[model samples]
Target chain A: MKRSVLPTIAHRLAILCYIAFALFPLFWLLKVSVTPNDLLYSEGVRLWPSRTTWDHYAFVLQHSAFPTFFKNSVIVAASTAVVVTICASLSGYALSRFSFRAKYLIVALMLLTQMFPLVMLVAPIFKILSPLGLTNSLTGLVIVYTAFNVPFATFLMQSFFDGIPKDLEEAAMIDGATKFIAFRQIILPLTLPGIAATLGFVFTAAWSELLFALMLINGNSAATFPVGLLTFVSKFSVDFGQMMAAGVMALIPAALFFLLIQRYLVQGLTAGAVKG
Target chain B: MRKPWLKRLAHASEPWLYSAPSLILIIAVMLVPLVVGISYAFRDIQLLNPFSGGFIGIEHFRDLAKDAAFYTALKNTLWWTGASVILQFFFGLFLALLLDKPFWGRGLVQALVFLPWAVPSFLAGLNWAWLFNPVIGPIPHWLFALGLMDQPGNILSDPRHAMWGPIVANVWWGIPFFAITLLAALQAIPRDLYEAASIDGANWFQRFRSITLPFLAPTIAITVLLRTVWISNFADLIVVMTGGGPADRTQIVASYIFTQAFKRLDFGYASAIALVLLVLLLVYSMLIILLRQTLLNKD
Candidate 1:
């Protein structure tokens, strides 16, 4: 079939427009972060400033508590991702493979978790964690994030597991391997893409979470990126350059992780949405 | 003692063992807190006041009944969720369709367009907030240049238009999600079906209506339903951008709950508000499910 040139051009233009819309804000973010403070107001609407400096980034990294926030966020988000992925993998494997008594109940509970406002749990969780001394701790953030993420990650991993043929594991089991061994040695190798996707998803989620972090963590010592940045914003509202620099730094890890796993995420989402 | 009963029991319990850790976490962190949170709604549980953890009955709810701020927030939640979801869905659907047809550099374009989703919600809020800031951001200047306003000013500070700031940010961040999902569903539609439709003299819109719509109906329904519920509960943008400010114009139930708990340290009142939001969401979900059921039954 011969495609019309006009339609093709129009389609390309539309895609370009969408791409620009998506990237413009991020571009502006980068733009303002590097612009010299003296020129910020004068060249407010310029697509690109004639001259730019990295002083803002330097100041944020050197003079601010952002490094601590960055490290804390890495610890919390990485720990939560690892823990959530482990729990999700096991539970997801069961849901994909087994016909158990509590299967429906488990599904129902997970769905219920998704349905309600997570904000509802804030007060109770704080109250519960305070006595245990988990508040203001990275471990507490990890635990809460792990639980909040597991349900969706389980669903995601389940869909990926479903994509793999059951015959592969069945064959392993027939060779005198326990079901667990078969799953470990045979199935897991096949689901590496899924695992990567889940890790990325949960990592991004834990990284970006704002309210709970704001509520639980108190001082700059324990504050995650969101909390620290927000505090910085409120305190130094006029330091747009430094704030944008911090924001740009925060975007790096999540964006890199996302670009890596987005393919599998879309694939898994399709499998779950289409087949289920 | 290699007993058959023991083996049978282990076989039956295998899945449970595998699921136990996650189950324990969920019960401990989410389920227990949920129950305790519900209990909190019926009691007085201020964080600062040592004498405030008493049973308060429905007094909080009675106060909620007359709270003008609560009503504004409730109304804003509907508007925020509705506008954000609809805008995201349509723009997302358009982008998905555009990407569905293979093009030069499609992979690169897809990644570029979906990059916004990777941004932390807080960062997205702050980024948009910066854009709307008149001093450093360009949006206000653009709006002014277009004669939409008399001078460059922060939209985030304008009570009448404050909600749109977050809504716009949300749409930008959320569009990629719908696009990715819808694009997947679009690709799943059989190519031959489109060929046959075209051969039968059906035009693009007809093909879309008859073929694409049906293929995408289930996904559309599910995503829309889920997004509506999720977006209503999403308050990070509002909190970060406006803090529900300009006299609480952009406050939603979720942000209102946060305000009560975090700022006021009124855990009980926050829980009370959260409980009401939860109930309203449950009703909304039930209605959607019932509507889906009746539609299925009709067919």
Candidate 2:
């Protein structure tokens, strides 16, 4: 079969176009963040600015409330990731290993959770949390984020668990090890990629959550990155350089985690889809 | 000593014990709140007024029935969801097909193309809003140069064009999700199938129509349906970019719900509107399921 050069060029061109479209926004973000304030308007629409500076980054870090927001977001997202991963691993293992009667019911409930609008829960959750002193706190955000993330993470972990051979855990159990010990010592180490993928996914999701965070947390002391950035944007609408600098900082952890675990994430999704 | 019945009980309870933490969390944080939220639709629950919590008995729904803004938001939701879903799906499918073929620098290309999904929704919104701004952004200037606009003006403030700003941003952000899933499904198709098709003298379109389409049908159906529902509920871009401004032109039901709750501080009305949106979504989902069932039955 003679391969045509035309199709190959077209394919490469299409991929390049897609890549440009995807990264153009982030590139613009980076460009504007580094652009000096005076040049932001004068050099508008230029691919690169004539002059650039780190002054905006310094201002956001030193003068703004963004550091507190960043710290709070990191705490909430990391805690949610660790907590959701632990719970999902146990539940996902059970689903992969057992054929219990309520299994179908459990699956249905999780699916239901995925389908409905979560915005509906804002008022009720606020009502419930306010009295308990959980509202306006990072602890409340972690708890809420963990619950919101568990179902999807559980399904993800289940698919990963399904890919592994049951015999590894069974053999360990047969050697007088408890099932929990087998899962901890033998199986857990093997599923590190899956665990990493789950952590990354949940962390990104928790980091990005806005509406609930905005609704529940009021003060800047407990505000997550999204709430803080939104407030900053509204308050200082003219400070494009500073806001873009903050936006660039917000993208770092999520992007790093995503680039690391994206391969496993797609693989896990494929496994789940085939089973369904 | 442990008896056989006690051992049997432990065996039966093992999965339950494993699932208990997640189940409890879901019930406490999600399920209980959902029930309370549904209840809120009937009661007058004002955020600031302590004495406002009372059974109003369908009063909010009645007010909602007459509200013109609610109706406009409902219409906007359909337009927003439809445009975003269709554009994302086609672009995503094309990208997936392009990536599926072996090419140089494929890994790097894949990483770069999917980077948009990794950006937080709020930031994506702001980034796009800035892009459309005439002062610091380039999009309006480009539009002016292309003669698509009278002058370099921000579309985010234009009632007629405001919706497109968020829609474009959404399509850019969401394409990667569809591509990733479709790409996974594409890879799962056996390579031999394509080889055999080529041997049969089938052209690319014929092969794609007969082989690729059938192989990807289940995935396409599931992903498209899910994306439609999800996009309809997604208001982050709209909320962040326009704040549903310029006379509520970009306001979808989701953003409307946020406005009512956050700005008006009227929790009951917000819950009422949310309940209606929820019911509409359920109906839509049921219709899709039924349609799928019938298609399956015919086969």
Candidate 3:
């Protein structure tokens, strides 16, 4: 049976609409970031600015506390990503391969942890951190973010580990390698895509997290970019140009981070789309 | 290698070793705090000296029973989750179906559609806030030019429209995940099945209802479940957009918890609220599992 052209046309039209809907806001962000401050309010409804400048970007980078916030955010997010991936990989491999007595209970408990809303635990978390003088510090934020992100990351890594065949590891073990050696030398190398995907996912999540960062850190020096973005909005008026510029600037690291791992990300997305 | 006692010990101990790091981190950071939170919920703990307070049993729970803000937050949270998940899934499924076929620029379109998922949610919320600005935002301006609104700020300021702004933003951000997941599921449907349907003279709608819908149901159910959990926990966007404001009309449970804990420093009361949310989510997940089991049994 031949497919009809009308249905194909309709299908393409629908997709085109979705693409526009999704990308419109991002395009708007890029547009407003370049628009001159004076024209932000004056030119009411223009898609493209009449004139553009890098003034807001320059001012946000040079004059504001954004750079510090960016640096702190990088430290916190990167550390959390590395920490969570390291933890999750070991657990995920165990969950995938082992049949320990408490395996079922452990998986259930991890799922239970994911069920609780983060908001509910905020006070208890703060109380626990404050006594150790961990509150108002990047390390505290990293610890909290890592805890919150690990459960989901573990599940993510577990799925990846499950996808890889057990034959390879069994073969490695038979060749006189210990189980640890089999995992480290044989399985770990094969899981580079999973590691990259997990790292990217966890990094982006911690990078954009605002609640813990806002609650745990109070001062400008330790604030992450999300909290710093709030500084652009005062009680009186919002600095649209500056905020948009900062927003654009904040996209750089995450964008670069993703660009570096796009190969893995693409592979990760498509890896399980079809059966091997 | 064949020593049974040593092998059993190794097998038993290996899991513990493998899972120890995750277990310790979760226990220290997640489970301990959760247990402490439950204890605090029964106490009258202040932020300054959380350990100093004596346990008041269910006093905080009783207080929450009469709290109007708590009820409002709960209601708003339900509204947020229901609206966000339903809209995102449907729109995402629609897009996935549309894009399942071969077409020109399909790869570019898929990339563009998935762009929102790539951008951070905080920035997306910020961008939407600017877009909805009454005087300066192009959206309101466009609405006014089309005679759809009398003024610019009404949408963001009005209680009725406040929640919708964040919902729209969330839906925009979420559609991509559903699209990608559903597209993956759609592609997995064997081409031979579709061809067989076409041979039977089934039209597009008939083919979808007879074959596509049934095959995609499991994936769709899982997607909906995941989306529900995620959207229910979504407070960051609301925090940026309305701060649960315009008279707390948009105060979802997550944002409310943030304010109660951080702003008010009422650790005990906040913990009680958080416990209630945890219970709700558990119940929701259980319900989904039951429904999924029943659906599978029907087949």
- Report per-candidate DockQ: 0.56, 0.51, 0.52
What do the candidate models score in CA lDDT, each in turn? 0.86, 0.86, 0.81
User: Candidate 1 chain A, which ten residues in sequence have the lowest lDDT sum?
Assistant: A267-276
TM-score of each: 0.88, 0.87, 0.86
At residue A63, what lDDT does model 3 achieve?
87
lDDT of 3 by residue, A118-229 (tens): 7767767888999999999999998898888887778767756765779988998888888889988877766666787678778888998877787789989999998888
iRMS of candidate 1, Å: 3.0
What C-alpha lDDT, on a 0 to 100 scale, does residue A232 get in candidate 1?
Answer: 80
List the candidate 1 regions with Cα displacement exceeding 4 Å.
A1-4, A96-101, A159-196, A262-276, B1-8, B184-218, B291-299
Report the C-alpha lDDT of model 1 over A1-276, residue by residue, as the tens digit. 357988998998899899899999999999999999999989988989989999999999999899899999999998999999999999999999999878978976876777777877887788899999999999999999999999988876776676677988999888989999999998886666578767876888899998789878998899999998888888898888899999999888777767767666545544444443
What is candidate 2's lDDT per residue for A151-174, written digit by digit as tens? 978976775676567898899989
RMSD of 3: 3.8
Query: Can you write out model 2's per-residue Cα lDDT over B1-299, one digit (the tens) per residue?
Result: 57998999999999999999999999899999989988989999888999999999999999999999999999999999999999999999999999888676666677778888878899999899989999888899899999999999999999989999999999999998788767766765667888999999999999999899877776677677767888888888998899888898999999998888888899888989988988898788767767766766765
- Tens-digit lDDT track for model 1 on B240-278? 899999898999998998888888989899989988988
